[model samples]
Target: MSTPLAAALEKALQGRVRRSVPVTDLHDDIIPCPAADLFSNDYLSLCTDTRLRQAFIDNISKEPLVFGTGGSRLLNGNASAHLEFEDRMKTFFGAPAALLFNSGYDANVAFWHSIPQTGDAVILDELIHASTRDGLMASRARTALYPFSHNSAASLRDTILHVLRAHPAIAAGKATAFIALEGLYSMDGDFAPLPEVVRLVEELLPAGCGHIVVDEAHSTAIYGAQGRGLVAALGLEDRIDTVLHTFGKARALTGAVLLCSPTVRKYIINYGRPFIYSTSISHSMMCALSTSFDYIESSAGEELISSLHHISRTFESKLIAALQYTPSHLLALPARSTPADFPSNVVSPIFPILTSYPIPLARFLRNLGYRTRPLPYPVVPRGQERVRIVMHARNTEEELDELIAHLLAWSLELQEEEKKEKEKEVLLATEEVATSKSEPAKDKALFTISLPGTALRIAVSVRSFV
Candidate 1:
């Protein structure tokens, strides 16, 4: 108890914080489990695609290497294959330069901690990914979080003005400000107001120094005609200062890339600790990522994005309708507010199933043979727990239908139970009112009553009859 680590460990255990279960084997369909896998960030089926397997094999044949990188890039680990992969990524993402990282977390930490100077300011969205926040905290620069109302350019502009006004000491040529946000949010599955944010940054830059950075971790290899990501899709590749793309999601592989100007690349390579101290990515992983990029360049990647969009749209339509209808001959329940109006130009393949209690939803789905993950508090703020359903191109239409059907069935059952509980409450209230009227002269006290195992409670006043 005296030790901080021991206290924290005890709190975690007592809180029953769930641990992530590692999968030893793979399967095609995740059904009949206690929860469905609506929480994965894997937007493309590439994670399990057969073509990627062949691509990996082909790359390994061309140049044989093992699992580990012997040293850092500045040391013996700097392989020619890594250089070639970076070059290919630079071309793919249309950046002047690209640098590889062990993962998105490492990339963000390296960039945020080392890139900005001590006098610099980082104005980031309030809801940016946790990794970016951790990176910003580790940085030497002064940072401020600004609420942009979940993709409102007007809000961002106001936030920028507020930050400048509040930090007058830094405003007068003492510091520079950088704006950071994600192209697509992981939780809401919505995009940032890039055009407006970019415009505001440019307007501010004329008066003072300002820069913009975007984390394209969820947008890469899934948007635009060539799958170049949201920034490229919007034709704002030249407008943003830096873009971070991870290979784990859409690329269905490992590693990450930080796309920036040549100057920024040089600065990071010279100063970034994660890149300098740690061993570089292995030649094999580099080659695998290279081959994955090649596959993206081919027509198959385009087709896959298109297929993913179609599946996403289909799933959305079906689920919305199912939410509205009754299942199993029961009355339907009232729906909560939708997360946000669907963006006119959606890019990512993630969608949110907003629920009051995500754990119960996950449990219900799991009982029906769907493998879903529940996003509880801490990852998201308290009271915003949700089931994040991600669609992949490889998922069959039939599987989607079955998943929807089970959800509809569960909803209907819950509705029936809720209706019964409400009726019981009404009846109890009526009895209380009747008793009070008959015994108006007697003093009465109100007592609370609960309908067992249902989300309904009632208060009743009792009195003696005259």
Candidate 2:
């Protein structure tokens, strides 16, 4: 229910605007949802993998099954499974060390708060995930949100300069400046201008300035060699400082891993308040996460990745026909879309459908058994609200057909509705004009006017003329 404070908002809309906390509105239960699965993050459908299921059974049957972590890791929360998993990840990802966190949110929060000393500043893309901003807010470090580069190095440099100007300590080399970005941005489904930003940092930033941190959450388990993510795929392992890999997306798991230097790992273990204070992940969960990594290196995992990629490209190839739209708007784009996230570069299974009637389209699809994610105002900018459709490896061609057909129908209906709305406005304006035109001469004003070219003064009463 909406609170008394939400009265204006409640009255402003007539739809099912339930005042509630936010959820991605991705997909419903895996059991039975009477809708097309077009928005789930289970990209590779590994959640239902038989091997994973076997691992789950095998781990569950192990003697002395532990249900809890007992306490936080610093206390009695650490487990053998946790250590084993970390070691495997360290070796697997080729990082100096790997640290596990309860979840991506926890890892990011800890990193943002623990790093960046009071003198240091965090320079992030304006569209960086909210969790990062919240973490920075908790820190004593100076924070600056910069304009998105949209893949332009010059634009990124300008944004960094602006941040430096605002934080003189960073300019004077007294404080470190951390550049934050994502390997794959969730909303826009775009790749960050990482190389360019790193180049800028190398060329312009003062020595001992700071590090470039990245959230490879969405891209993990999808891109890169052995599914390390787009950063690894681009061979940018040396350029990035810290990388956050989430197991929630393509991996279909429930935790996160932070890849960084061993020194940084120790620092995080000690100073990362979130890790020290929160309950350590359970041994069972840790074991399950381990199995996931093992599966990623298997041939089945490789095949799944290939299939998912094929699905993404195939779906993208068909988006134009389904959207029935021009490639100029924020939502519409071509297959394998590269640069210009309005002037950022992006390529992913996510499709953002920008529309004037976003809520209606989402609702219509929902009624037709398609679960779509509608991004409304506040979630996105007012005019940039969109319907986000996530493509999955498990999704079939028939599902794509259904998605396209329904989307086309909705677009046509919206077009007609928009036309009618415009017609109504024009009619109202025409009526107002006609009323003024037919107002029978209230009073006539005679005026002496000189014609251009004739230069003759003429007295004329305009009221007498039609």
Candidate 3:
């Protein structure tokens, strides 16, 4: 009981908590079907694609399974499959070379720990993935988390200028600075204005002073040209220093790859602790990944990506129209402060709709048959709790309509709560007035009604959701 680890775990558990919800109460076979799925990351519907399943079976049937590589890639674990996967990724990403990692977390850890030299500095977005931040914390170099406002090029310039001012050694050519950012923010479903950031790096900072770094774990896999990602779409591969892409999202697979120069790859291969310590991916998984890439090149891949975007766009337009009705409290991003109108320029399939009572509302949706999850405190900041919805190619228009219907019902629920709360406040205020009326000896504490009681009934709405 007095163990240090136990004490730490106890401290960490002193709050509202979560538990794993099994698909079935007992086994995977007894899965319960939910109404609408809104939390999946399979943007392309590739996970259930018949072609991919066939490819997996074909590859596994033809090739002998290599079980698990018990050693790291730097050791005897290195295999032809591993090398081939890396090569294919490098070519696909248009990079000088590419390196593999067990997952995005490992890739980020290796990158942050090894790349920024001792004298170098790292300026990263405050909202960068926790994995990336963990890696930064493990690094030997100095690192600072800049504000999320750096998503704007102008703000990025200001933040860099401010950082360089404080750490003059970096600006004075004494130490190098690296700017780290996300290509497409996974949580907010927004972009980083990378072109502007890239321009700032190219013109404002010298080659030796700093370089642009991006984590494309969300965007590049299924968003842009031929599912290559934002970096490729913007032709930023030659400009940005290090870009991390993973198969977990759109590819519906495990593992990640880092696209950089062969020299940098060599450095990471030699010095990156995460890459050197962890066991390599399974041989069958590697073969499946290889086959998946092959599928990504086919006409089917192009159609799915296109279809996903179209469905997502259509869903967005419908949701916008629904949430904009009079007295609506549903909040969307880019208008965090309760905008007069929600933006219609949603380019991503992910959206975080704010809710004051997220868990109850989420549970209500779940019981009503939607697989919607509430993103609270640790997932997002407090008071910014949300119902996060992710669209996939397989999400039908009817399912989207049903989800929106539930959302509208929830919006009505919020309205009802607000109305009840308002009426209670009014009653309390009237009681206070009656108490003052009772207190008056003469005219000493005479209570006055500002307007007719009927007028008060028709009074203006109070500041609520805002």
Give the winner by lDDT: 2
Full-model lDDT for every candidate: 0.73, 0.74, 0.73
Instruction: Write down the worst ten-residue block by lDDT for model 1.
Output: 330-339
Displacement of the residue 82 alpha carbon in candidate 3, Å: 0.7
**Estimated TM-score per prediction?**
0.83, 0.83, 0.84
Top TM-score: which candidate number?
Answer: 3
lDDT tens digits by residue: candidate 1, 144-225: 5454566666778887787678766456756677888898887777778787788788775444467789999998888875
Clashes of each: 14, 4, 1
Expressed as tens digits, the lDDT of each residue in 412-446 for candidate 2 is 66556556755655565455446767565444544
Instruction: Give the range of the ten consecutive residues with the poorest summed lDDT in model 2.
Output: 338-347
Q: Candidate 2: which pairs clash?
A: 150-344, 151-344, 190-346, 341-344
lDDT of 3 by residue, 1-466 (tens): 4999988876565433532111223432222345555667778888778888998888888887648876888778998889887878877778888999999899998888888877676777778888877887878774454554636667778877876776777777777778889877767777777767877876766556877779988875565567888777776778888888888988889899899878889998998999998889989788778877777778888888777778878887887787777242344544522111222222587777776556666777778766666775556776677777888877899988988887788667667766776676667556655665655333232222322111113222222111
